[model samples]
Target: MSARRFLPGLVVLCLGAVLARGIELVLGANHLLVAIGLGFVLANAVGVPDRLEPGIATHKLWLGAGIVLMGASLTLDTLLEAGVVVVAVIALVTGSTIVVVELLSRNVFGLADRLGSLLAAGSGICGVSAIVAVGGAIRARESQVAYAAATVLLFDAVTIVVFPIVGDVLELSGTVFGIWAGVSMFSTGPVVAVGFAHSDVAGQWATVTKLARNALIGVVVLGYAGYYARSADGSRPTVRTLWDEFPKFVLGFLALVLVATAGVLSPDQLAAIENAYNWLFVLAFVGLGTEIRLTELRKAGPLPVLVVLIALLVASTLSLATLSVLL
Candidate 1:
């Protein structure tokens, strides 16, 4: 309720967004990436002053809200258009990444199972969101969750820049690059950014593929919750448990998707919604960047980072192979 804590943080975020826009106009940079880079520099170089901490904390809300609104872009026909093959590729990539990351964390890296699972979920599924969800399900330490989030952020920045270049160098077709981007990316925004930055066809395919991946977050989280419940307390999971654990924001996305499908909103209205989601997403990403404390990541040691890197490489390699077969 105090303005001192919230207002300062809000102002800094606005400044970051404005700066990102300026970079986009001048350099044709990806504004989301710029916002993240700007926030990282501000945080690491001079530190985000303590007064603005509260508003920065609100970024999670922004991330959720923005993602929900992003549902406006999805419709039933588009969803169906993604087809069975694309869905199969996504599932394969996700399952493979998680299994490989967990195995490496346990056998190769010699980390605890809880920490290993958190890292695996983050890298394999939806980055920070999946890490936080699975971490809670498995009762992972807060420190472990932070480390997993940081590790994903590191790759998020790297892949954001590198994916486009790799696609171009390989002269990848739009469909191939789209599948690759959707399966390999841990988050939707970066997938959209990289795909669109390359070509329109790639962007369209990426959005559908990524959304399909995102929709499975609830299923994946419920599975983890059930797995841990039976192991820890010997309680079998039930329908109620799955309902309680489901991500509500996904429902919001689905509602908006129905609205889109029903043709309830005019084109202009949908455009405005799209614009709103972009702003919210950029703001959330800026907050995410500021929250990353490099010191904590360093404390996480080499194993977790190595596991994430390897998992990413595996995901990338596997998705590429899948694209070869499908495309």
Candidate 2:
């Protein structure tokens, strides 16, 4: 792609990122949420120019690359220290959440499989990142991707604030509550912010547990790709197709974990890479927001939100059950 052709979309994303940064600095809010919201406002208010569409289409690529860089922040030693309980809780929560959402999307929402799958990933696994990853794995349509993201962001924003308050009210210990937040919250940023808000111990535990959860995303996406290919096309994907469709960035992410565990990179170097990850993610969110049309989301109806609302309850119950053992 020529720089000239890509410049328009790049400019649009840069504007969105600037606005997001300003909002985050002023309000102490999640920048991705702000960026996406800004994108939504521009998309619904005036519409994006055709020149920017090609660049915006690269958001999934940005998202994938960000996930890879995110791995550098996680060390295998920390993962091991988190122990089997945390890993088990994450696995149970991730699997159960996806299953529940997928079922609800079909029976309750009457939604299509493609859109429903993205919602499952977004609400169940991580959020927009996981949604975009699974969306790419399945080759989901742009409208479905937007609907899934809009649906999750709506609920995730509320949890960012509410979870901390609830933890305080319950007077849960930092370790317990950190596990709760790590297992329950839909996104990484909110969980870390809320966990630390509760306590330093909670924050530490939350980061480790959440990173463990995030690492499982690749395996889950691979499973989804297999299931989707079989159910949608009536032919099982061959090894070649799986190799082609599987997210290579996830492998890169795992490699970074090894690098992080190796103890070669200085703290400053790792921090710099993390900052780069944030910028990449911001760009991705800006691209995502630019595509969201309020009109399209409205057409998707209230069921997506309903699905997320139900997920909150399911997540809470599962989180508490796991914490009971861990605590």
Model 2 over residues 1-327: C-alpha lDDT tens digits?
577888778888887888888998999976766776777677778787888888777777886677688778777776576578787788888788888888998987799888989988887777777888788777788888988887776666577657877887889998888888888887765665566567657765775677667766677677778787765542333456445544467578779889988988898998899788778777877776665555544554588888877877898888877687666
Residue pairs with backbone overlap in model 2: none
Q: For candidate 1, lDDT tens digit of each residue in 210-258?
A: 7677666677777777777866642344566456545567678778889
RMSD per model, one decimal: 3.2, 5.2
TM-score of model 1 relative to the true fold? 0.83
- The most accurate candidate by TM-score is 1
Clashes of each: 0, 0
TM-scores for all candidates: the values are 0.83, 0.68
Best by lDDT: 1
Cα distance off (Å), candidate 1, residue 44? 1.0
Which segments of model 2 are wrong by more than 4 Å?
26-30, 98-233, 302-308, 324-327
